[model samples]
Target: MGAIGSSADNAAAKSFNAAFKRETLKGQKGWPSEREARLDAFHWLTRYNTRRRHSRLGQRSPIAYKNALPSTTIALTQAA
Candidate 1:
């Protein structure tokens, strides 16, 4: 986390990051443009979040990991 500025980049250090990069760069060498990159990145993120397995998650996909989260809600008040 120290080397990277964003928490999201830090979180990307996990095992799932390997699978994500491999799948994205498998067929195409590189993206054509900003829009193309965005589209491809979105598609990969969706697939990874829904289907990629994780040993730390007891071999469950990230989607499963999220779905298993306890449903709790917290109300927020505006600062007026």
Candidate 2:
């Protein structure tokens, strides 16, 4: 684990946050209500997890990678 407030320890999370801010919150006027912002974030997260491709996954979205895994491998992964 990284020390508190250390970016290196939390690089992946920080990268995601930077992308979220850039992609989801960069330009538009602020949401009129907190509920709206929450809804937008939910939708964004859904799409990101299901559809966004990652270089480390050989250009597959996380859902695609998981789906492509063999059942036995998945079972072993879950068992662990």
Candidate 3:
């Protein structure tokens, strides 16, 4: 967003990754098994994407915000 290789470009992504790691890890060394790790990540991602309300989205969950939008239909035309 700012420039190539600029921190601002990936600021949002970095913040999200940090939050995911911090909350998922929870000060633990590591998960006991790969299965558990996968499960934990799955659960966290599910809740994060659909259940959590984001301030930037006006305190609505992503799904809720999307549902609030008016539906649009795109018509396709063949190029002559």
Candidate 4:
């Protein structure tokens, strides 16, 4: 889980759980079937990685941060 701090992370987890339930779980909190939840989870995971805005990263989403960085740094890295 790409969670943050302790208390805040718990709250965030609950938020995602609810979002997952509504968007993917279809309102069922418990899994009547195992793999269905897994499938839903995988889909949400994709969105979380590619779509969510992360505050710690200065509002840039994960995909945005990854793409914005230089792929290969020079000796400037050491100087910094």
lDDT score for residue 12 of model 2:
76
Clashes by residue pair, model 2? none
Tens-digit lDDT string for candidate 2 (1-80) = 58888767888788898888777776976787999899989988998989999998999999999999887634345564
Candidate 3 per-residue lDDT, tens place, 6-76, comes to: 77988888888898899899999889999999999999999999989999999999999999999999999
Report the C-alpha lDDT of model 1 over 29-79, residue by residue, as the tens digit: 788798988998899888767897878799999888889999999999989
lDDT of each: 0.79, 0.86, 0.93, 0.77
Model 2 TM: 0.73
Error of 4 at 62 (Å): 0.7
Which residue pairs in candidate 4 have backbone atoms (N, alpha carbon, C) closer than 3 angstroms, thus clashing? none
How do the predictions measure up, each by TM-score? 0.51, 0.73, 0.77, 0.52
lDDT of 4 by residue, 3-74 (tens): 565556577678877776787756555776788778778988898788888888879899898999989956
**Better model by TM-score, 2 or 4?**
2
- C-alpha RMSD for every candidate: 5.9, 5.1, 2.5, 6.1
| Candidate that beats the other on TM-score, 1 or 3, i.e. the better one | 3
Q: What would the TM-score be for candidate 3 when compared with the true structure?
A: 0.77
Instruction: Say which candidate scores most in lDDT.
Output: 3
